[model samples]
Target: MDHQIQRGTVVLATPWGVAAIFSGVGSQYAGMATRLHQRYAIVRETFTEASDVLGFDVAELCTEPSARERLNLQTESQLALLTTSVAMHRAFERQTAGPAVTHAAGHSLGEYSALCVAGALPFAAALRLVRHRGEAIADVAARLDGGMMWVIGLDTGTVEHLCRLWTEQDVHPVHLSIVDAPRRAAVSGRTADLHSAAGEFEARGAQVFPLRVTGPFHSPLMGPAADQLADFLTGIDLAPPRLPVISGVDARPHPGGPAGARLLADQLVSPVRWHAVQQRLAAEGVGASLEMGPGRVLTFLSAGTRGHPRPWPVDRYEDFDALARAMRLGADDEPAVLDACLRIAVSTPTRRQDTDVAGHYRRLEETRRARKPGAVATGLGALDALLAAKGISARERRGHLAAATGGRTWQ
Candidate 1:
């Protein structure tokens, strides 16, 4: 399929009961979507097109270590994440067979990818839009001394009360950036206010960790970015989304076009109701959801949300197997549908809440690479290649294979 074709996500529904989810910025890592780029012509062309629009090589940016690290910065992460997600979605569409996605949702930056999937925004336009937003956000961060902190072990009510308390105490503009799960939230503000709030929460037996970010994203502190973003969007005319896309601002499905633009713009400074979005999708009977891009964050979040829709992650090109399984299971087959339902009903499908995700996973990935090497050396694990090339023995050599399995490491 050409990039010029009228696309997916136009309020469209797949015969299968599924939702397409997108991963956000924090999910960025080196070598993201590399497998897709190497195996699928569409994925490679997607990055090539994005590279042209961004005036740099997006595919190389994802593959290169230093560039990928730069992508973690607010200015770069959003674009990289969006490009990878859109590329993956586009490639999936061209596949011979797969499950249909009835709904789509994205976390913060991921929403742009969802819109692209919805066909509301062209891929190039989406890339340009995210780049502009990132630049605006980076500009705001450059001028303002701000940061974000994750407050754990605290209820939404308590977090809200704390925000109110800080405001009352003259902390200026401290605000909740995201309600990640039931008791987990990310608060954004000036450095002092963020630390102040963290200290307060910690004193009350809550755990707080500073997010690896340069800006106070999703808070009133982003007003300047919002302004710049609105001006940047002045010339763009977004088409109506063919598929239903959820808005992080209010956790509601947006009906594309001007309304979608408004919702995206508002999300710049509004708290991302990610947990609520998960709940809404679950309530809508989205049997299973797939995180389209690298990182299992959304998959893990599924375990924390209100209902277990059985999130299958698609962090790598190999992760498409899970996507295929989702489509096949929900293929209107009574037995397969019942099997999935029973699996979800019987399993909690999540980890303990207090895991040191950032540190632990980084180390875990490093160790796995050291021990296993080959495709596992990169986050995209190609077991077939590993088997094809000397079967994971002392030395290694290989060619890229076609598969869609997603895991921080090989599943």
Candidate 2:
């Protein structure tokens, strides 16, 4: 007879997907997904009266790699976002001390998940609420010509001042979106405004670029969506949270119950106070920070400033055991902040003393002329930065014209 042991180290020469599934952040996601699916089957069955109307295949969409593709559809995206976050919150709570949570918050769609975890709304109710929100908000973004832009190397006050100045001078208003870092802010509005702002920032030596979202989110343009969402939520039952959760709208702890529901609905139109959320979390002495789903975007955005100027730590399932072990050692003994900083710092690009500024700009001109959007924009921006560092003016770059759109220049 053979004896089996789990939760113990087993050495292997090769890294497998199973290992990813069992380790750190990956394991949390897997556990959350599983927990949600089980509840989804039971809950969805109750609400879905007809097979044709409720035709979404949860097991297939969630389990398949192509699930994210389905999320591109507004309805599906909302559902998946809600389900994944809520499930993760539930799973995480069970694993950690339930009373250890002093404050809770989420970024954008993740806010609903936070509320669910905090007990302001039930998981099923939150899912249904977000579905309606996704549909309403997506419809508005499609109609608007506005979008978002990332502004790096500028203070938030400076960015806001520039936006006001730009709008006053006939350039559309730069809707300051989220303050992700000390020098990083996301601005939203018309595409023309964004392009103009990007050009201005580049002229002033800041790295500005577009994000891959379809519509202008977190601006006044989302007001209609907020209204509709509010109407929908008005009919739903809400309860006081088991714990306090911070609001991205104002960065204050929500009062829970009906107030929480209203804030969740209003979040569609409000700017996310991600910077404030991070500050609050740190002030509360939260030693470990975990991004509940998908990309490391949230983790990067929420990292502490008191540390060596890097981003947040990540505890994906692969590091779950380590995180668990660390948490057991208590907050004062936690390694999350240091771990997060190490992860980001090690990945930062190292600048060489002999790097070429002019030649780099020339290459960017060629790439932009070739019409690969991301490569063109990012490449050109980096080229511009290098050139500026070498004291090269934008106008003096002869091939800069090559980077211009053919009779359809960006700015």
Candidate 3:
């Protein structure tokens, strides 16, 4: 393929590149550099008590070292992560020309960033929430001594089965916290339990790595944190979202209803269905995805699902010219066709509700109908073949289709 041709499909093809910019946190770092004069205002202003307890300077954790260094401390790490992602989203708005953010979703603390992006909460309020969250985790980490770990190349089923066996063998019952893919899952619990689980997984042909989190997040152990955070979040005034935001706990699209913020607080103690988030986005026809922050973590999380073109890692590059080249899309060309296809698939009906699948089919049929006779024959023939693959009889539909094609018979 020509480097300029981009490596993917147009509408029904895999997305070649993301048009919209999804970002958070990095902008905050830039703003903090000028605004705070290296004071670390967000953490110092919000997490006063937690900062006092940790003895380490929260400001230094957030602004003194590099962005990657801030990520080392769970509290500062998550806060900076959320703030930076929000900043990136803003930067994207300044840079891109498109509809407002269609929908948003974040992993763990990134949920706050999503909400901020959607305008459900203010920047300062979100910072406070993160501060409290960090304090709660730091408190728990100090007392209970727990941590989080990532396991690669194992499906949830296998991980759950292994965890059960580990529990039977006197190891703690670690909870599956984040399911990023069919093969990648993160678990959380006491450090000892995690260590023992790592040993057991290593024995079973799996790789386990520890995360830089202070507490056993998204587990029963975090119940106390959730309860406290719930009180704080619920008491605050959280406006409805201006844009769509996905729920990390359920992998469902949150409608910015009354319960949105409450659910966010509850997320602290619930498993993050990250796998579902990416799958749902792909299913819904998101052609191109952009990972906003420093690392390619979200894009990495989305690797297994179909529809989305490989996610574009956007950083360092000042503009999207490189990305557009990579995706093989021109400024004038409609966004990738695969993105449209994904939208069609995702918007398609389900047993619980009527999806727009019929609409998609109608649109495709119309486009084929409008094509030249020769082209219609080829397209209908392809549709017939696809129907056959699904064991559906297209004979009856084929006749009507042939008549519509003006005797341009396929076969």
Candidate 4:
């Protein structure tokens, strides 16, 4: 574990490989997204765009240590985590020339963030949805007096047994909320139940670490919140995903549309198939994946997962080049550059457009603008500085630009 925490360079294979991206709650703190903000225009722009939707200075909140700490408050924490994950991905996409990843998934609140990034869900609307979700979860936890604990060094079967024993004890029963690895599981229930189970779990030589979370999330205890979330999403519009996104619930390619919404809603009361999702990604041909967010949690879980060569943590500017090297950039490797890190899904006939047609059309217009020539103009700000060193002929530049953007104007 100590060695895993240390910094080092990665040795990459010649052909490069596909990557899967995942992020979840926890591992958030003060100034989590500030590093990318300092170095990448995409990160800065992402926060700014979210800020407009949220009606608060999200960028300021994330970069300011004091405010960032307070951001851990229920609803604030969920939004902050999502914003940071999106910022990291956008920064990563801006620097890379082609598809960086072929698959993606987000755990719990992270799934909503994934949906927003995948273009299946709009950024502003996702924020509104998750904000409501976070609040509902917090409310349920308050009403039910919920709590959670992490039991390490125990398989899922053993953890389930322990949970059953406690639930039978009839003092605030807990259930598996997250199964992250072969020996890692989180049991959630009432606060007292979690506290009582600690001794027995530890007595059996397992490491019991209670979470500083607000609810027994992803367990049956979250049934109320799940129902509320389901109803809340009924009026929202969702589109088909462009690139495939794995579901945290079933560990399969999410069937985008209303069905996807149900899966997300059920995630509130179901154990997140964390370990299974990674294995599934490997099974599906992703040779590698990057923890494109504030922490190395997912990267740590990738160890020993089949077909996955281990993931890299792209949490800082230094990580960019290392990830680039891993992707075999500039090698004989074809740029399988992922489409936009976050793109709207293809129109689905089953999708019900939001009632606000004007706003919906405006968002559609933005999507169209994004596909036009030089749409990524702002993201290329850094590289623009380097172009001054040499002058290529207008004709040659136009030809190259035409090839890349389907004959669209360069500027």
Best by TM-score: 1
lDDT of all predictions: 0.67, 0.55, 0.57, 0.65
Rank candidates, TM-score, best first. 1, 4, 3, 2
Local distance difference test, candidate 1: 0.67
- Stretches > 4 Å off in candidate 2: 1-55, 66-68, 95-99, 168-170, 307-315, 319-322, 326-411
lDDT of 4: 0.65
lDDT of 3: 0.57
**Least accurate stretch of 10 residues (summed lDDT) in model 4?**
333-342
What TM-score does candidate 3 reach? 0.65
Off by over 4 Å in 1: 1-16, 26-32, 169-173, 304-306, 316-323, 326-411
Residues 120-206, candidate 4: write the lDDT tens digits: 888888889988898888888889877888999877888887687767887547898888888888999888778887887888889
Which 10-residue span in candidate 2 carries the lowest summed lDDT?
A: 14-23
Higher-lDDT candidate among 3 and 4?
4
> Which scores better on lDDT, 2 or 3?
3
- Ranking 1 against 4 by lDDT, winner: 1
Each model's TM-score? 0.74, 0.64, 0.65, 0.72
List the lowest-lDDT window of 10 residues for candidate 3.
Answer: 402-411
Tens-place lDDT per residue, model 3, 1-411, is: 011222432222221112222432233344442233233344244434334545554445555545545566666666656655565566556544422345577777777777777788787777788878788767766877888898887677898777667666766678788787777788888888898788877777778999866678887788888778877776567788776577877767665544776687678777787768765654443444566665666665566554433466655444434433444433232222223323333343343332343454554455444553233223433443333333433333333222222211111
